[model samples]
Target: MGELEQKFAAAFLTEGRWILYFKGLGVTLGIAVLAAILGVIFGTVLGIMKLSFREDGKKTLWNILATAYVDVIRGTPSVLQLLIMWFIVFATWNNGVAVASISFGLNSAAYVSEIVRGGILAVDVGQMEAGRSLGLSKAMTMRYIILPQALKNMVPPLGNEFITLLKETAIVGYVSLTDLTRAANQIASRTYEAFMPLIGTAVIYFVVIKILTLLLGVLERRLRESDQR
Candidate 1:
């Protein structure tokens, strides 16, 4: 076995290099959380903008902008976007993780914006009118009546988006971020024992996402139970 493999195998049995692995894990999770949070916020605003169309000209403009953004982001591969964000947008910066977060945040924002738009469209028009009739401003109606219901509908999809963002973080390795996947890649490169490191990384991702899915499930159940009343 290669030296790195021996070290890893020993570590697997005895907690060697555990600190580095956990540090990488922390970094990966940190980026995923930050990106997903920012993405959702930005997306909500853009989605509202896309939907805020009274005049035909305004509608056309927002539609074109939203459509172009969604199409371009969805059409292009994420890794390429990461590279562009790294080399072009934050060229002078040395922090690879920051670049990764920004790229993922922006890319995810494009998708999450569509999710928000769909959720908003799903809300009943009568409820909006009711809010307006109750002396609520348009903004107040949206904030109080429209958005709350839409947000409930948004949770499942947003959770899925979080999972997707977590996986997408692997791409940060290309920019040399040393995230979980990057750590595994480094270990594999040194050890020449590809399967163990890959399996380890996959397990890490699976466990993290599975935990999130379970938590979201509990939240979904609570939301549904409340809705039944």
Candidate 2:
């Protein structure tokens, strides 16, 4: 092996590199979790607005706006999206990490809104009617009854979205965010052993996703049990 490779391989197996790896993992996960939480909140609000039937023009406008947001984010490449946010929208934030988190979060929100809207629609209309018959206002029924059920149904899809967001956070590298992918890239540059860094990053991502999936599965089972009772 080359001298640099030998040195890096030793570091990779040492305590210091392990710490750096874990630190990068934390940053990646932190960004993802924050983004997922913010996305769900924003998405729910947008989804509800899109579903509103009050004004034809207003509804159309909201639909057009939300659709535009989703289409634009979905159509463009994620790396380019990160660069745009870094250079354009968040030029003032000056914090690459924050910019990356917010951009990805907002992007995720657009997609999540559609997921939530589908879940809301999947509920039978009869249920809403029943809720209304029981002296519940539309908003009340939605908040207490309809939304609860819809959210339960949304769990599986949300889990998938969470996994996707986790992976997408890697794009933060474009913004100079020192996330797992960036860390791996840096290591590869120094070590010149492309396999170690890429494979290591892949393994870390896989383990994290697996854990998330397992946790979501537990949540799904709990929700199902609640439904049974």
Q: What TM-score against the true fold does each predicted structure earn?
A: 0.89, 0.90
RMSD of 1: 2.9
After superposition, candidate 1 runs with Cα above 4 Å error: 1-15, 56-63
Predicted structure 2, TM vs. truth:
0.90
After TM-score superposition, the amount by which residue 203's alpha carbon in candidate 2 deviates from its true location, in angstroms, is 1.1
Candidate 2 displacement at residue 180 in angstroms: 0.7
Cα RMSD for predicted model 2? 2.9
Which lDDT values do the candidates have, in the order given? 0.84, 0.83
lDDT of 1 by residue, 78-190 (tens): 99999998888899999877778888998999989989998988999999999999999999999999998998888899998999999888888888788888887777776
Cα-based lDDT at residue 107, candidate 1: 91
Tens digits of per-residue lDDT for model 2, 1-229: 6976766575476546766677788889989988898999999887876676655445566777877787887888877878888888777788766777888888889889988899999999998999999999999999998898998889999999989999988878777778898888877776667777788789889998998899999999988886646
Q: How close to the true structure is residue 205 of candidate 2, measured as C-alpha lDDT?
A: 92
Show how many residue pairs clash in every candidate, following the order shown.
0, 0
